[model samples]
Target chain A: MPKIAVVTSAFFIASLISVPMGPTSVHLLLPGIVGVLLGPAAFLSIAVGLILQCFLFQFGGITALGANALMMGVPALICAALFRVLQNGDRRRVVWSGALAGGLGTALAAIFLALFLATAGDNFFAVAKLALAAHVPVVIIETLVSAMVVSFLFRVKPELLSLPRREDAVAVKEKLEAEAKESESSS
Target chain B: MNTALSWPESLLVLAVLLAPLLLPLLYFILYRRGRREGLVAPIVSLAEMAGGDSFFHRWHTGLKVGCLLITCFLFVTLRTIPGCLAGLAIAALAVTVSGLSWRRSLARLAAMSGFLTLLIVMLPFSGVMQADEKSFSLAFLPAALPLRLSGLHTASLIVFKAMAIALLMEPMLATASLAATLRGFRQIGVPVALTQMILLCHRYIFVFQQEAARMWRGMRVRGFTARGDWASLTAIGNFLGMLFVSSFERTQRVYEAMLCRGFTGEMPEIGSEPIKRHDIGKAVFWLILAVAPLVAERFLHDFTQFFHK
Candidate 1:
């Protein structure tokens, strides 16, 4: 539960990091990374963030809050599933899968946004298409960014990804034994 | 040959389009200046909005939230342009009664301006023109292209409806502190776990944002600019990885502290006073306001029927 809180905080912080996209800078939602980290809890985290965004910045209005939540939250959940399927034992494969899930998560979100707008009526088809088209670059950037982040975490902390590595377990056991021996000797 | 708007017409269109964006900017300046001169204490955080002794703040949050939700749904149900205009008026009245400023109300509208503008601009061009509908063309545009007048009406109605609901949101949710608001949600049947998560996340967002800012400054000093290139993406990835790594470590420490302090996976309830009779009366008042648009639209329906006869 505390992990949920901390990961939610990280999600917000990631959004603060704006990656330049042409003349304008765009904040990466980082939903994919969040999904991979939090698994099913990603929806809860995204909903919390959206609720805060609605109240604090008023980006998504209250009436549309549920719709916004559904759009983003659903994508994050899907990203979690995608990550699970894409990941294998190979470190390089883990990075690729994470990157793919990140990019696909964004693409799916754009689709959801389009679908939400299209619900307005047939008159919104063009606008929906435009919105979807606009997100293409975002998807690319998020994929690249997620790939790098995943690789870095893989190197520094394999535990985050719950990698099944015998070496890491042995290292932890050895360290614990060393600590135990030292405490016993001192006593 | 395509018919085109004269300079005056084009300018008028531009002015009409820019009004939503510009009006907010205008009032934002005046509001800030007034705040600086002590019109009211400047907002430190969104939760602080519940601090004032206004009627909205004093009212039962559950009732307030329920009424506002109903009001928003009613706003969406308004079909006619005049009906939506009335809805907007009701929203304005609500804002005034709640003692919120033009800055806040207009800021809500501004947040929605981009999408609303897109809908307004594209709907006319996107939809098929009926025989009764009117359309006009601009110079250099294809003759086959038509801008349906009916589409414009629906689009603007959407704009008015959206504005009405957006304007009401702050007074609805922000009239109570975060805890009280969540408690209201709890009263209205939001799950306890969800509320706890929301409260926890909201608190941690502020903490982590400061840490992120500090780290971002360090990166800036090292000459990192988000150029959207490969190097920048790699740097941002590493940065996020580091942040998450720290967060995971913090998670363990935070959990340990909570466990040590006797956490049982349940947060104590954020207590709220029982709903008063006057709170019910206020709810009824809001209910009436919510139905006002529907009633007016009915009257409009009859008047049009009579005129057509």
Candidate 2:
């Protein structure tokens, strides 16, 4: 849970970095990678971060906050599930899965954003269309960037790539303690 | 009333329609240099102004959160132009009474101008015409794309509602410390775990932002400036991955240290005052203000008819 919180914090910092997309630039959302790493906790992490941004920072108004959270968070959960189902840990497979999840996640977020705007009525159709069109560059960048991160993690820490189960986390900690005692006695 | 306009007259109407939106959009860019635009950095010090003994500062936090939050939702539901205007008036009054600076409310308005301006521009031409609705067509431009007045009406409602809620955000949120605000949320039935996550994430956000700044400086020193290219994206990808790896690795130590200090899920309260009778009165006052727009949305046509009679 603390790890989830920490990752949420890091996501804020990561999103501050702007990437040029043709004439306009966008900060990285990376919710796809966040979903892969945090799994079910991604939505919670995303929502909490958004609430802070909305109310405290006032970056987005209160009404749009709920829409924005669903826009980013729902796609993240979907991408996480998709990646988990397809992941086999092969180097090639990880990269491809990561890329697919990243692009699809952002595309889904854009679609969700458009849909949310459409709730105002058919009058918003054009604005919705423009919103979807604006996200084209974001989808492209996320695909390449997500693939890079997945492959890098596959080399650096293979275990972190697969979702870390709670039971396994506790078990591993106890195991480390037991091993330390054994080594102390042997030495 | 065959008020068909000539080409020049049509152009004048279009300019009048667009001027309100374009002027502010221009001002936000030219005057402020778009201070809040494109930046995801948290404005942490915003709540520092809560220390002043304003009416909102004295209000009960839990009730404030609940009432104003409900009010924000109601503000957006207004369909009638008159109702939306009424909501904005009430919101502006609330801001004045709350004793927060108008500048803060202006900042909130600035954040949403770009998207709202886009809506204002596109809605009229794109909206499908309905019975009992009005539209205008340019003399020279294609007759196929008549600008729907209903679309303009809806777009105006969105703009007014959004601005009202944006203006209200300062009085709603900045009147109390963030911890108090979360506690208020929790009191209003937001889950404990959820509130905890918000508080925890907020705390660590400052810490991590500093760390990222340090890392960014190192990257800059190594001649890795961010730009609109593959190299910058790749560098950012690497930077993010490194952050995750480091954050994950430190968690074990972090957890153990937490456990040693008897870390529990329950957090201490932010020390709020007990709700008074007048606090409930103030809350009731806000509830009425919030509900007025909805009432107008439901009956404003009939209301206008009665007045006409």
Candidate 3:
């Protein structure tokens, strides 16, 4: 339970520290990509990064840390998974996926905040409704911001469109080539 | 004494009026000359400088929490009009004396508070303007519910006023804490991931602004002035679409780099000290300074009533 508290605290802090409006919104994509590239371990690392942020910056409240981490971190993980699925697909699709993920992540965070507030003894439905309504403008703003970050990355570094190359791909190719050479020698 | 406005209410109004003017004066006197340090540092320093060792020695975490709780209680009970103004003043003073320069601290506070005030003032007006009213097409008209403006029911008006004030307070508090977090992080050794995130976001703000500018140029070039709704939507959509694509690619690369650097499961700390005694003392002193006006206002109200009687 203590470990959970610490983990949640770290996650919450990282999420909040990254929450401010800036170029870091793109960083939201990092966790997801990292997760896809490196697996679940990346998610834990991202959470740690987020927690470190909270500790250093006090961006998110200690009480609400768990929710914040899940809110931001979950989307990042989802985006990374989606990126992996579409790694071999068109760049346009990748861009759209990222945009959707970014927008959804922000909207989800707002919703989570509302839910957390409600459960913490505030008027649940009313707070949720108000929070949802209030966040429309913010979501729209973030969506646009997210989209821009995606496009900027696309223009400058197209290679970033793909996941980091897996070592298995090269190894498999080399093994196939060696097999072919052995067959030719036997014949 | 007329029961129309509470003592806290009147004090809050005065604080609202005075904070803008007083904070700037505080900033100019203490922080304007400091070249290297940012705005918040000087005000905090001044607070410590003013109170000396006593300010630094007394450290009670509970007191700081208590002050915050009191501020929140005042907010919920009194609503935004008075409670928020008072809270803002207190928070500003607290921040100023927390070892930050007056200029940076005041500027930070003012920017945050000012944005909140503007949003509160504008939201209602904007809502009213955007409302599907047959009359008064101007966006400047009030958008408040009819039950609020009828002036016939005094109690209803009070309730409406209180609700509006409370609504205003929530966002203001959020913004204040957000600013504090940003400042606090910089003071401590910020983590690499966090720092990277902030830098990327900051950079993209300029990137988006440039995108908007280019869209405007395109509009001008095509002989399509932004005079109509169609043009406005076109310009906005184009800019948004372009921005999304760019940011997506950026994230992909940032991730690849993180993986290369052995970013395993946690952001290792670069090391940071806990809040210093002086910082806490300064925070408390300013907290008291913020509350002083409220106490004074209560006394003044009684004094005025007694003299008048």
Query: Best-fitting candidate, measured by TM-score?
Result: 1
lDDT of 1 by residue, B46-162 (tens): 575677767788889888877887888888887777788889888888778777656676766766787777777777678655564556663334658655656667778888898
Docking class of 1: acceptable
CAPRI quality of model 3: incorrect
TM-score against truth, every candidate: 0.87, 0.85, 0.41
CA lDDT of each candidate? Answer: 0.77, 0.77, 0.41
Model 1 TM: 0.87
Candidate 2 chain B weakest lDDT stretch, 10 residues: B34-43
Q: Write the per-residue lDDT of candidate 1 for residues A8-125, one digit (tens) a residue.
A: 8778767766777778767787778888888898888888888777766667777777898888888899999888888885789999988988898899999999998888778888
Off by over 4 Å in 3: A1-71, A80-103, A110-168, A181-187, B1-80, B96-99, B110-309
Q: Please compute DockQ, using alpha carbons, for every candidate against the native two-chain complex.
A: 0.43, 0.47, 0.07
Q: Write the per-residue lDDT of candidate 2 for residues B1-309, one digit (tens) a residue.
A: 023568898888677556546635654565566464322354555566788787788889999989998998888777777888899999999899888877667766766777777877788778666655566777866777777766676678778898888888888778987778778888899988877777777777777777777787788789875676878777877777887787787666666787788877566665666889999999999898789888867865775342222
Question: TM-score of predicted model 2?
Answer: 0.85
- The per-prediction CA RMSD against the true structure, in angstroms, equals 6.1, 6.1, 12.5
Span of ten consecutive residues with least summed lDDT in model 3 chain A:
A10-19
What class would a CAPRI assessor give candidate 2's docking?
acceptable
